[model samples]
Every structure is written in structure tokens, then in C-alpha cells.
Target: MHSSPRSRRIDEHTIRSLPKAEVHVHLEGTFSLLDILTLAKDNGVRLPGPAATLFDITTHDAFTAPAVTSGGGAGAGAAGLSGFLRFLDWQCGLVRTPAQAARVAYAFAARQSASGVRYSDVIVNPTHWNAWHGRELALMDALASGFDEAEQDGLCAVSIAYSLLRSQSAADAEAVVTDLITRRPHRVVALSVDGDEKVTGRTGEKFRAAFARAAQGGLHRTVHAGESSGPEGVWDAVELLQAERIDHGVRAVEDPALLDRLVGGGISLGVCPRSNVTLGISPSWHEHPLRRLHEAGVLVTLNTDDPAPLGTTLEADWAVAAEQFGFDHADLVGFAARSIDASFADPDTKASLHTELASVAASAVDATTTA
Candidate 1:
């Protein structure tokens, strides 16, 4: 629960102006408070009491509250990531149509643009969206359409990573990957695994066949590991699932051999600082192993795991990295560069974003100099 005061060396404006890419954001977790309210009312879903009282989606600590009540009883705070996952299920459930899903995607794009995110690899667990019940492909198309619409408007460019929920069956996981490869939905970049890792207990061996299929089909691989489970989960992800990038691999700091493997293999760890604190994985930002991982030669990248639900933006994460980890502006820029390198984006797109990020950083520096 402890944290250092915000650094005076960085300001919100500067942080927002830093061009960045968000590789770990969840599409279902992108719902804003206003969007939540609108979706619930439109679908005749009742929420607990006043919107503000349900939960404060403004701070990381608040996300640790108990189960959120939907209608009658008092809304509980999010107990942990497990509780948050249930809340995510309910929030995404409110969108019962393709158009609504599109709206959610577009809204997420708009929010990311406002925070200076130039690119995003948004993850979605299709099972969580009840609206997509028997129409997963349709849901994917709608989401792609929304992202395309946003890209057309010159907002953030978007991609999708069809995530397999850990709670689901191995057969279900293979089916999702099979469908993703078969459909080849627009802007689909990779296959991913998400959900509370503790419940799943490092079942990487179970998904190897599916991941192998994805690799054969040219889709990239990334897996959620080492967040809730131990370093062994990360090891399984690398050895069995062949994850090119791991979401929240902070626990790798505990195992020297695992850390060496990550370093040698050039696997990127998409570290979400606020998420770790909110989920009780790390006691505070200062205690986070991000800097340690970076210093140890791990390809570390900063990201907002779930912006709206966690009440954190990429800009906020960068600021915290600066304030707590003593990263300078250049260091923040490097984090963005590494994200681009680690992304499943096409080479041409990656080159374009690299150029754009450099220009933006130069401009920001020039403006600071003049001031």
C-alpha cells in the first residue's frame, strides 16, 4: 500500500505527449464508468446503488476490494484479480450485440489516443462477452470493424490477441486458436492466454499443441504467466507454450535460471506496475521488480494491463516508472521502443511507429528546452 510521491520532474502533460504502445491492455477491461452506465441501462441490467458507490475505478488500491454487487446489496470492492475478473465478465456481458461491441472497441481506441498511445494490441476473451455466444467470428469482425474505424479516423492503430481464459478447457483453448487461424480475422496479430494464473497452475503443457498450431499458421504467441503463479509458470510458458512475450513476468526475478533464460531468449516481459500493486503481487511501486528485471537484461516493457478497470493509463504507468524507478524521459522512450520491438505488429508498421515515436520525443524535448 506504500508509494513514493509523484515526481516534480515529470508532469501529466509531458507524460501524455509521450508516444507509446500498449501491448497488454484487455478489450473487455476498457469500459469507462460512463460506458458501463450506458451499457447497463441500455441492456436493462441493474447496477448496485449510485455509480460512484459501486467502486472507485480511479486508484489501484480500490481495485482490491471484495466482490462487486450488481443490484440489491452493497457493491463490494474488488477482492483481487479473481474478483476483478468476475467484474470484467459482468461488464462485458452488458454488450449484447455486434454494434455494442464495436462501440466498446471504438471507445477504447479514443481513450488510448487521448493518452498518447499510438498503437495497441488489445486482448479479448471471447467467452466473457455473452453477446458473442454462438457468434465468435461475428464478434471478431465487429471488433475489427471498430478498430478499423478508429484507425481510419487517425486515432490509435489496433490489433487483436484472442486470449484463452485459463478457466476454460484445453479443448476449448485449442478450438479458439484453431478458429483464430482459420478465420484470420482482420488485425488479429497473435494468440494469448489470460485470467488468474493461480487457478490454472501453470498448465503450459496443456496448450502446446494449440500454440504449435498457431506457430505453424504464422500467428505470434504470448502467454500470461508469473503474475499469480511462481516462476515455474514462466518457465512452462517459455518451454512449452513458446511464448515470445510474457504478460506480468515480474516473479521471474526470484529464479536466477529463469531470469537468465528470459534474458538469453530475448523474451519481453510486459510489466504492469499498477496492476501488480492492485492485485497484491507487489506491496508497492517501489518494491516492484521491473527495474531489477530491466537491469538484469530482460527486455522489459511498460504497459497498462487494464486501463479503465485498474484506473490506470499507460501515461500513469510511465510516470510511476519515472517517479519510483528513477527512469528519465529517455528511459521512458526506450521502454516504448522496446514495446514496438516486442510487439506482434508487422515490420512496416513497427518501422513507422519507431519513426513517429522518435519525432515525438524530439519535439517534446525541444519544447522543454524552449520553456
Candidate 2:
């Protein structure tokens, strides 16, 4: 019993028009090596390797260098966040000024705009580029300036969560939170706990304190939990530090109780499927638990994590999720709404965005049916 091609057309239209919320994007992860070279040339920084280094987005042989980190031991889990972080090490080297920061920020925003992302919480690693210039304020200002420019261009709205490198002192992480509270970039909305979580098993209480201070200051909290490790890390993020969202909670399936806890708590899991597949989390996209979680009532939001390096876009992620996760119009729209519920924005803004998403999603359905 073949229904019709019209059903397929409607499905594709609905995916494109589904209102979207991108809750986890690393500003450094957004740094494409090609984009890095442009910034380097503008700032006159020397990339130690070949000009070809401009496009190396994967586990690089040049792990310890300036641009990005990669090729870690199997213990560190390269090709996932490690490879992504390595790219940050590279991008931050070239961003030495307020102008440079703004350029990078704007470039990332433009890419987001092209992806049809309506709201984004972009993670910014302060020390990455700031170290090159020896100025923290420049990184902050560049982010602020970038948002200003993007809004004027009618691009999608964007926000920043100043990410503390895992290696940074509690004092340094606190300093960044202090800046967020004091300077208060409207676009810089939250304080994200990023960097390698593996540091905690080896080290001390700085991670705990940094998140506590951020919470005490009324900063919205998100953490990169259970990305590489097991569901225990997810539990640690939920029980120990009180994270609002888990960046990659793929292993939640391993613990049914934890899985139920996430669903019951209404915590959004920023699931990156292709990234999981590329990094070997699951053997293939079809194996991703995003579908399982969504059906199980966990708030699931789709994101690219980083686009250029992964050569992925948010729209592409949605498509894959739709195809792989068996998402229908209602499912994706519900997923979009989940992002709104978990957002750090004020009620009015969140309300407005919600309205916009619904209207757009409705119109998309109408158009699809008509065509």
C-alpha cells in the first residue's frame, strides 16, 4: 500500500522548518582551519605547519601545537571532543585582539544563520585566544561585539557561555564568571563547564567550586558530562555538580535509573549523533540513543557541537536525526520546544521565540501539503 510522494515532501519540509534550539556549540569548535588561516593572516600570526594546516579538521599529527588538540591516547578519546578541543588550541592562537575576536564571532554567527538555527548557546573558551594577547577583556568584548553585529544583520540570536579550560585554576574559572557577572554581556548568557572532564578523576575540587560559584552568582549552568566516560560521569554531573543539561549523555541507556532520572528531571541532553558515529561512540548513526531517549521522554535537542571541523551543520544534524531517529513533524517540533523549556533566556524572549517556532513550523506544514 504505497501512500504517496506527497508524504515524503511534507516530511522534508517539516524538517527544514522545524523551529530549532542549539544548546551546545563550542566557539573554538566552530573555528574551521580555513577560518583560522584568515584570522592568522589578518593578525600576522605564524601557523607552525603547512598552509594546508588551514583545513585539517580531524585528529591532527600536530596535537601539541597552537591550533587544535588531537591524536590523544585511546584513553583520552580522540576524534570526539579531544580532536575538537585540539582545533580550539589552534584557533585561539590567532585571535589576538578585540577585532580578531569579533571577526571569528561574526563568522561563526553567520554560519549559524545559514544553518537556520534560531537560538544558540555558544561555548567560548576564554584562555584559548586570550592567552595569545595576554588580555581577557578582549575576548569578552569580541563576543559582545560579534553578537551586536549578528543581530544587526538579522542573523539568528546567539549567546555565549564563557568556558573554562579543564586545566584552568578555580581562580581563573572564577575570574571568568566574575567578568560575566560584572560586565554582563547580554549575549553572554551562561557559564558552561567545558574542557576535558577526565581531569577531575586525576585531580581536585576546583571543578566543583567553579560550578558552585557560577550557580551562586545566578549564572545558568551547563556541563560537558558523560561525553567520553560512562553513565557514572552523567550521574556525577547530575548528583555532584547539578548540571542543567548533559552535553553527551549517550550512555544514559546503560543505567535505566539514570535514564529515568534525566527524563523525570526534564534535563535536556544535547545529543550530537554524527559526532558520536565519527568518534566511534556508536557504530553508525542508526545506533544513536537520541531516538530512544526522545521516545523515553528525555528532553533532546540536536546540535552540531562544531560545524566546520566536523564538516557538519545544524540542519544536517536535524536531517540525520530525522532519518536515523525516525523523527516526524510532531517529534522534531516537540524537540524544538524542549530546547525552549531548557533555555537560559528570560520568559518574554523565550515566549517570543516559542511563538516564532510554532508559527514557522505550522506554515511549513501548510506549504508542504499545498505543494
Candidate 3:
């Protein structure tokens, strides 16, 4: 799986040029620091520090700073996944109006387009958005308006995956699903559940009915498991929640049986390497289970779980898979194809992305041979 230095450079170029889809990115965690600062000022929300110093909040240094494990207080010095979640709450709270929500959504699409991501399943959790709690449908409309505009302008096409926090009660989960089914908001394609699974403990039973409702109501289902929890959580996601895709399910490598299940069932894992490393989920890229899962025939798609806050991009993540994880050019291309396949996009869109990727991959091969 090792690539030569010259081949690595070519693979990087190929990765950058490939048409890709990100299946696990969160809208709340995708806000650029500049966007956060601008929204804060525009919405009359004060930052913990001066505007100039706020830029460091998403820098590499900030992740290693003292960990602020819970929400509340100033957000500038926060670190780790918990602190990142708190930052998402604070950042999301700044969108006091639908216009601001639309603006951020458009910015997300623009960012993805710049990274060569032609399509994306952007997760939007109403729980993190303190401002739009009661008016979640309105929030979805605002986000759809922005994404629709972005698509019309020839940016990336986006489908919203409305998320339920894992800490929510079954009733609460059902209520969210009910709203999704009843309102049928524009561009919402999936039902997702995310939060601190470690804090909430095992919640598969709690949300089972909700996920069933989502399935019956015609929404794709994705669950956050095996990052904070273990293989059992992934089992819950598969057996109980019946997840079509698992987000951060890197820990499934720990269980041979679970790996078999994943491989046999064809469930995709939206693996985010930098996010795992940044959050201390896998310690380092060298030790991350993504390679192991890939080797085991489990379908895996590379993603930037939280691009802006983690300070990485989708293309950079693909590069990491090649350089650090020992994936060759062909493997990188396979990853691109897997991303499109694992996405919630319609069959026609998936076919289009695959055809485009095949063309780029063929061009890369021709160039390499001629060189």
C-alpha cells in the first residue's frame, strides 16, 4: 500500500481533482472562524475575547490548550471534542435570523465546492442551535433557501440530514421525526442522531422507535457510534437503530464479529481521520482503525467531521489517507467512489459522480503512464 514520493504527489493531485461527496460533515461545526466572528458581530453577540484573538479558537494551538469540557462560559480557550461541541452551540447561537442561517449554509456549499466536493450530506442538529429550537422547521427552510441558492449558482449540491441529539428522550426523538415527516422540509434527505454518546451512554433502545418512524417516513438513517462508545454501540446502531451509515464508527475494528457484520451488511462508515486524532479517539493517524476497517472489506468513506473547527478539509483528509494510511492512487480513487456510494444522494446523482470520478481516475492513470 506504500506509495512512492512521486506517486504520492500525483495521488494528491488526483485527490484534489476528484469529484467527491462528504457524508458526515456537520453544519454547526463547519462555520469558519471569520464567519463566527462576523455572525457574532452582526447579531450583536459578544465574543469572549477581542475579534482579532478569536481567530485562534480554531487554530492547532487551540486544540491543545486547556480543555473546556462543557458548554457555557467563554469559548475562546475551549479544546477537545466536548469543548468543540460547546463551541458549536455558541457559534450556532449567533444565527438569530433566517438570513444568517442561509448565509452560513451558502458559505458551507461554497467551501465544499472549493474543495472539489460536488455533493454533500450536511448534518444539521437543532439541539445545538439554541436560537432555533422551537422554530426548527423555519431553520430548515432558511438552510434550504441558502443551499438552493448555492445550487442555482452552480456550487455544491447539498442535502440536509436533520439530527437528533442522543440525549433526547424517545418522545423527543419521535417528535423531531414527526416534524420532519409532517413538514417535509426542503432538501432534507435523512434522519441522524448525534451527541456525546459517552455522556448519554447506550441509547439505541431509546431512539429505536424514532428511527423506525424515520424509515417508514422515507428518510435515510445515520448514527453516531463507536467513537465515544464501543463496538456494542455500533451494534446498537446496526441492530437497534438500523443505521444505513455509521458516523465515526472506527471502533468497530475492535470486534471481529462486528467487522464481519459491517462487511456482510454493506453498511458504510463515514470515517474522519483528523477529527479522530484531534478528539483523542484513536490517538494518532498511525493507530487509527480506518486502515484496518478498509482492509477488512468494510465500506468506508473519508470525511471532515468538522472541517473548520478541526482545521482540516475533505481534500486534505484524502491526502492523509494516502500519505499516512498507505493508500495508493487507486485506493484513493476507491475512497472517492465509496464516498459517493455511501452518500444519501439519489441514484442518478451517485451515478453521475461515479462517472466523473472514473473519468478523472482514467486521466490520472494515463498521465502517470505517459510520464
Candidate 4:
């Protein structure tokens, strides 16, 4: 069943012009080497290694391990979870000031816009930012400043998903929920979990109270599951966390019942095809479960989980889904519609995006006919 790369090629122009929404991208993973270099110098933080060394795609290889967070266990070794944490720790160290945060946020917005992403639910795990240790609100405000500026300029509209890492204590998760509910930053939309699911295992039981608090406080919930573990991880997310959406729920393919539950519940899976392959969750795009999941009535949306660090873009991710899975323009539009429907953006924003997506699809069809 292996297909040649060229055999599945999608129309790059059509996909690029198709407006889409992304719901599973991380803010920290969007830092490019240039952004990292600038922030390191500005903050007086030593570079972990040279930019060339860190950003070299060939050096990392495609980690073929299932559900391993990009740095958690797949990076150059110290091997295992600690090494990945160290890698993420070093990256988060660079942005020492609010200005640096804004810079990175702006860059992320610009990059996403280039790939036709009109809206994004960007996950920002405060636990990752060692520099912002006691100043979480300040950090959120700074990132908001950047994203707001981007929005004003008609780039991608963005909302933040404040994440709680599974490695943290349940008390810590509760604390984050309290702060999020109290502060209720204008751009903050959802409560999410971002961490090495494999290392922490199914942790929904531990953070169940916190997620409950978030739900009561009117925050939407999503969790990273079924990436490093199995369908059990996803089941715990839905049953314990009451997750409305799942990040990387690709492994649900292994469980027929789980797949049924996801479809029945209408929980969307933000499948990052390239990120899954690069992180070794799936062997390659050709073999990815996205197509199968879509065919099975599971709502699937394409995205770049951490494009800068992973050397991918939303455009490339869409292309891979089309080329490898044989999704045509109409199918891509369906994916876009699903992403919009699943997003936590304001109702007005979602409505507008839905209309925009329809118009874009119709225009593409009309142009094709004219040609």
C-alpha cells in the first residue's frame, strides 16, 4: 500500500489559497533559529548550541517513535524524557523579557498567515518558560500584546490555550486554573494539557479536579493524548478531562470503540501529520491514520504542531495530507470547515470564518472553470 511521493501530489496553489484554522500548534515550538538567536543575545542567555547545530533538520532525523513529544525522548541523547525536557528548557530560556515574547508571537502569526491560516488556537505552556517563573500573568499579557498587534494588522487572529503539563502536581494544575479564571486574559480561550504523555502516562485522574474547575469556570478543554500512549490515553482525556478536542489522537485508529466514541461525541482530532511522522508516531505520511480516521467519520484537521522546531509549515502539512492521502480540494475544504467548527474562537469569528471558507472554495472552483 506504499505510495510514491509524486503519485499523490496536490495542487499547491489551491491548498495555499484555501483559508484554514489550526487548533493544536504550540507557541514555544514556533521559535525559529533567528528568533532564538535574537532573544538569546537580548536576554544574555547562552545559546544551547550554535543555531546551525540546533536547527539542522538532518541532525534530528525523523523520530519514528510513537507519541514521543518532539524533545521528550527523540532528540540527540542524553536519551529518554530528561533529555527532551532539557532541550525544551533551553529553548524556553531565551525569551527573558516581554519584548522577546512579543517578537516570537509576532513571527508565529506572520508565518502562519503566509500559509493561509486565518485563525489559530496557540497553546502556550507556562511551565516551559523558566524565565517567566513567577510572572505568569505578565508573560501572558506580553504574548497577547504581540498577537493583538498581529490581529490589528490583519494577519492571523490568535487565541491562547493556557496549558498545564502532566509532570506538574495536581495542585499546580489547580493553581493555573484559578489564575486563568481570575485573570481571564482577553485572548485566552481554552485550558489544555501539553507534555510528554508517555513519560507521565494517563494523568487525567490526577488533574481531573483542575479540569473540572476549568469547565465550571467556562473554559473549553483539550488535551494532548493518543500520541505517546494508546487509545486509553484518549479515553481518559474524554472521560476524565471532558476534553472537547484532542491533540494528536492518531492512535485511536487502534481502538474501534474509541473511534466510535470520538465520532459520536463530535470531538475533533487536531492531527499534525508531519509532526506525527517527524516525532515517529507514524512511519510516514503514506501510512498515517488521518485518512482512515476521516473515512471512519472522525473529524480530522491538518496542522503543524511545531513547525519552526520541526521544520514544517501549515502549507506543507496540508500538502502531505493531500498528496499522501489523496484528499482533493473539496476534501480539504471539509477539513477547514471541521477546524472552524471545532475551534474555541468567538461565535462571530467562527461564523465569519465559515463564510470565508465557503467563499474561498467557490472562488477556487470558479477560477478552475475559467482556466
**Number of the top TM-score candidate:** 3
Best by lDDT: 3
By TM-score, the candidates rank as 3, 4, 1, 2
RMSD of each: 4.6, 4.2, 3.6, 3.8
Specify the poorest-scoring 10-residue window by lDDT in model 4. Answer: 71-80
Task: Report how far residue 112 has shifted in candidate 3, in Å.
Answer: 0.4
- When 1 and 3 are scored with lDDT, the better candidate is 3
Per-residue alpha-carbon lDDT of candidate 1 for residues 218-313, written as tens digits (9 for 90 to 100): 999888889878899999899999899998899999999999999899999988888788777888988999888988999998888777766667
By summed lDDT, the worst window of 10 consecutive residues in model 1 runs over 69-78
Model 2 over residues 248-341: C-alpha lDDT tens digits?
A: 7788877889988998887888887776776677778767777777667788777777666667677777766666555666667777787777
The runs of at least 3 residues in candidate 4 whose Cα sits more than 4 Å from the true structure, single-residue gaps closed, are 1-8, 57-84
Whole-model Cα lDDT per candidate?
0.79, 0.68, 0.83, 0.81
lDDT of 4: 0.81
Positional deviation of 125 in candidate 4, in angstroms? 0.7
Give the Å shift of residue 295 in candidate 4. Answer: 0.4
Give the Å shift of residue 255 in candidate 4: 1.3
**Order the candidates by lDDT, highest first — what do you get?**
3, 4, 1, 2
Per-residue lDDT of 1-371 in model 3, one digit per residue for the tens? 56332234334445779898989998877888889889988987778665665535554343344433322111222244544555666778899899999999999999999888999999888877888879999999999999999999999999999888777789989998999899899999999888777777999999999999999999999999998789999999999998999998988999999999998999999988887876778778778888789889999999888777566788877887677776787888898899999999999999999999999999989998999
lDDT by residue for model 4 (134-185), tens? 8887899999999999999999999999888778889988999999899898
Candidate 2: misplaced stretches above 4 Å?
Answer: 1-14, 46-53, 57-61, 64-84, 130-134, 198-205, 368-371
Where does candidate 3 clash, by residue pair?
none
